[model samples]
Target: MSSENRTAGSGRLLTGLAWAVLLLGLWLWGREITDGSESGSSAPTTGDVAAVGRPPGVALPAAHKPLKPAKPQRVDVPSIGVTAPVVARGLDTQGAIEPPPYETPHTVGWYGNGIEPGAPGTALFVGHVDTETKPAVFYGLSAAKPGERIRVTRADGTIAVFTIDDVQVFKRDRFDAQKAYGPRDKSRAELRLITCGGAFDRKTRGYTANVVVSAYLTGVAEPRAG
Candidate 1:
């Protein structure tokens, strides 16, 4: 995965005061929004939505209302052929929400310390785009278009379904941690699937941007038996 680019900055560049300053810029990297999570922010206008390499919203389904809280156990993005475990993770010492380790590239990391999936607020799920030797769970995530369904199974016998809203690829320098990680409409349940994308820099061995698949709660279903 393009860790360096998504996180933005070489370890050497982000040191001492500069590192703290960098962290300050990426305040949302902490994604600890709870009691103070904003509500009812204006929705993004068509003009406000930015598109990168691929077009957004290809075959998306009808939007569904938000549901009650359910502890997500796993996530599946059929459009991307992804079905991976969702593990809880927190911010690192560098103040960035850590991704699943390279060794567990296929696993997805949920900001467990923050909002629960299908609940009001933004539930973040991150996965590796690639590993040193091969592609990871979200390697094809950037290609996800509208109309696709993302299902997250909870500990209970339920699944929270989210529909693709639009895809945004934020450059490392332009990434807005708060805006990107927070719920757009405070009353709604939103989901963000993030991975590294854009050009892969051989120097850093990471991508130059982050591919964020923005989605909203659309439907729920009974858990399927294995």
Candidate 2:
């Protein structure tokens, strides 16, 4: 094979391998959630600092009725000062969800195969915590506390307003994918924002834990008049 062809093939192989490892981790997490046999505890943290969980007396809003499915166009978290464009992402050839390209670290990847942002299911979104040189879009995700709002603008010209209820950091060794990704209430439109958390491991070239922020639709905003 020519040098260019060889490089292309090698790149594909590496991508496939990375996805395979991710799929394996998810499978293990699902099993742990289902069977409840995992023994490790996951400390809640973000970027090496302790995260704020739902404190006593902090009441969140009730869930709003699920809206018609629409693709997400953008996501905004005012508390953490995040405003990023959302891009539809699908499963790789290995059936694992693909993340946004490293070149576009500011973009968020929505799992297009899952429920839409305003639909009555958990809509999954992922972002990079940091790149080799700088913090990425969700670098401060762990600092978000319960009762904050997450606004998602959809293609239908409506905004889905969600209230944060949970922030957790699951250790990669004992991550629970079902608990992290599954809808907290099947009747409510929920959203999950995930990124790498805890400390970065030099040996593995990855983070020690995954930061998951859980929120549910609590209100809706009509599109602004043109």
Candidate 3:
């Protein structure tokens, strides 16, 4: 993880779709200790304000220790013909992960700060569905449906296959935190791919909502010897 927190910058990037799984107390205490700023009456924004500080009425859920996935280093969606190398870097000082070349046309992998991709908990993977001018990596992602396969090729050459469970679109302002970040049955692992969706919002330079595809791990394979 990098010593410098990157949220101040990336937060602005995913202004439409933001999530914070880390406990609220940890967030508030960290802010006080690191920035020396007293808490204020800041209403939750469309994005995850859980990152900024704990919201007044929302109490952080009980923490659940995450079971690390096999460490997915590559992302491949054969259904939509997506093959991209993953990048590992602390997206923000708060410990949320960042995807690679996010500002570019193609990149895949977990944002390092949040749950690890393929991990037991809900792992978040995000990409631009479409840029302001060009088609982006996940532009076709909305077409993927339940039962489609999403594979992650690890650095070690192993691959994990996950079956898509559901896909839905949500208005940015009405995005449900619990549905996006709340804890779930840990017996089975889940994955979430989020990207800008719906219409473009000229006022905010953000999408009107987000398209999310949820999947569950079905298989894991070790690197094959050549």
Tell me, by TM-score, which candidate is best. Answer: 2
Per-residue CA lDDT of candidate 3, range 1-226, in tens? 1112112233333444333222222443454421212210111234432222223554322222333445667787889778776665444556444434547557754645445555665666776554334456777776676667787775555576777766666556665645554335565566777665655444565555566677777776666688
Candidate 3 structure, TM-score to reference: 0.65
TM-score of each: 0.76, 0.80, 0.65
Query: How well does candidate 1 score on lDDT at residue 36?
Result: 26
Total clashes in model 3, counting residue pairs 3 or more apart in sequence or in different chains: 11
**Candidate 1 residue spans exceeding 4 A from truth:** 1-25, 29-63
Q: Could you give the candidate ranking by lDDT, starting with the highest?
A: 2, 1, 3
lDDT of 1 by residue, 1-226 (tens): 3444345444311121122223432565454443325310011222333453234435545556667676789999998689999998776675566667656878988876667788887788877766544567777887787667899999876899888776776565565666556567777788988776556555654455666788888888997679
Please identify model 3 stretches exceeding 4 Å from their true place. Answer: 1-68, 93-99, 222-226
TM-score between candidate 2 and the true structure: 0.80
What's the C-alpha lDDT at position 194 in model 3?
Answer: 62
Better structure of 2 and 3 per TM-score: 2
